[model samples]
Target: MPDHQQRIAYLLARYVNKTCSREELEELFAMIGQENGPDIPGDLLEEIWHTAHPAPDIDYEQAYLHIKPVVPIRRSLPFRKIAVAASVLLLAGAGYWWLSAEKKTAQITTVQSAPAPPILPAGNKAVLTLADGSTVTLDSAGNQVISQGKVAIRQSNGQLLYAGQPTDGSIHYNKLTTPRGGQFRLVLPDGTKVWLNSASMLRYPTVFSGKERIVELDGQGYFEVAPDAQHPFKVKVHDIEVQVLGTTFDIMAYRDEQSVNTTLLTGSIRVNKGSVQQLLQPGQQAVANNQDQQLAVRAADLRKVTAWKNGMFVFNDMALPAILREVARWYDVDIVYNTSPATELYGGGIGRDLQLADVLALLEGNGLNHFRIEGRKVIVLP
Candidate 1:
């Protein structure tokens, strides 16, 4: 084998074993985008399938098909080998993670020339507002601990973890805000885990005070309560409040969105809007209309509901405008409609790690609408 091919194989193996670093992932993907990226040996792929276990919710065959059109895949060889190999070794936990689908497909967009620089995907980035209103920038490149009183706030591995007990019993509120083109993970002092999406803010006390552990979220966030039966965990957003003893759920209360949705995953939660309260069971979602603030219940699409937290954009028959709204948030771009919003519904998903152009191209390939990029704005054409 050639030197480049050997290197590719090594990187591919490292990727499958889940040891590839961010720089290595960038290199591997650069090779994938190359004109003559080398193919992996079929035998090596077979070995990979036999040894490595695949990640959950991955349809390797579908993902392989998505990549085969653009990447080098020889039809002369058996399809099963390539598909199985991709299924087993192409774990997306690393940066080399590409598009995988559950019976979905992807077509790599062809670029003719550069109109502007690529808009990259969001990473672990946010702003931490201290109790005194002081601010600190936190990103994936940062790994440090910020001391505020007795609580030790550690930023590591793209997540903010709070350690130690608060010395003073007085409540101190700290806010973590992720601007456009950013996302963040946080562990509260009470051990509750929060994954904040792009263009979102989470405000909470440094310590769980009194009888309730309450936090305020301004956008979308996934929460896994610390299982405290003694102190009930509460989430307040706008006019709605979610009350729970201990539960796993997601709340999307973006003001721009038509409705505020609270999806329950593991435990039960009560969605309170004034005197009206709706209880949500596991696998159920409560939708509160923005205009009337009326709460409605429906079965939740678990995968699509939590796709962002899992590093994917799994849309399940979502309308074109709704999908574009999400894309805009992740890529930190403004969507200007040159024409009326299309009523088309789309399915399937792609990796959140892909670029904005790539994502737009994938969506355009569905023949929904033509998209043009102008600086930070994405203009839609009919």
Candidate 2:
């Protein structure tokens, strides 16, 4: 309940919410060392150390100052109480907004540390599972053709394509799955470009010969839908449906994700969930959750959302947990935290190709958090 602990909690919430400047971070660090520095739990110390350091190439002072401060909140509560209370309030607010006419707030925070897992190499490859249960693994080694009545499967250019001649009266579906630590790309018969992130699956028909081209998804995928004014491309993500005629967008519809985010890069599209239909323009993102009746639209930075496809890990004021999620996907590893970190922000750059240690080394540069990699698990210490 000391003022130092309260300030740390306040800053922790701010960092997780993607708002905290470098000068503020430096001030916080100095304050931590002065008063409650030793009071910080041992397990959380590693996370704190990681956040302070971020990466070896970073100018901590500059990176910290470049980021913005989040909306100010009352910071007088005890650290533990604030953590529990904030999470509870956030959950309740999201739930309450789902069934009422009240407007929902676009704020989020988490109590977690730096997310660097054991570096993992990309796995063999991914496979396309036909409706008849036949599988086709894609790579440069070999390419084969598989037919399930009418669809043709081709593996070329490191991608699996489902190109088929259309037939009236009947429809056939095919599935693409990427295993743990693996990822793949695919082009639907209708020219829809899909980049499936690791551990993702997409189910679509062989042909878009119907009134609407609909697909089901699990995990994350970025799509560039081919233009067809008359026939719209509808993506069924859980209960939400993203309808687009021709546009470039990204959809993070992973089941484990708290919300399905549909970020539009170009053109126009409509996101619908039952009675709720929200129109989106370029540079806009629509977030739909199971608890909400409608999709929430907001401005977004396309680069940050699609950084994985571009072969980088860009954290523009991201929380420790969210950052870890990206690391887990790319490295194909699990994360275990022994403690929560002192509220600090991580602002810098790291490539996806870097070794896991290199990434952690950067985080440790902050001198607040520490990390250890054990097999496929990353144990974070404060």
Cα lDDT computed for each candidate against the true fold: 0.76, 0.64
Instruction: TM-score for candidate 1, please give it.
Output: 0.73
* lDDT of candidate model 2 versus the reference: 0.64
* Candidate 2 Cα errors over 4 Å, as ranges: 1-118, 121-124, 140-142, 166-169
Q: Model 2, range 225-248, lDDT digits (tens) per residue?
A: 999988999988888888898999
RMSD of each: 11.0, 13.8
Best by TM-score: 1
lDDT score at residue 250, model 1, on the 0-100 scale: 98
User: Per-residue CA lDDT of candidate 1, range 25-130, in tens?
Assistant: 5576455434345555556554553455553455555655333111222334344544443343344433123322211223223232345577899988999999
lDDT of 2 at 321: 69
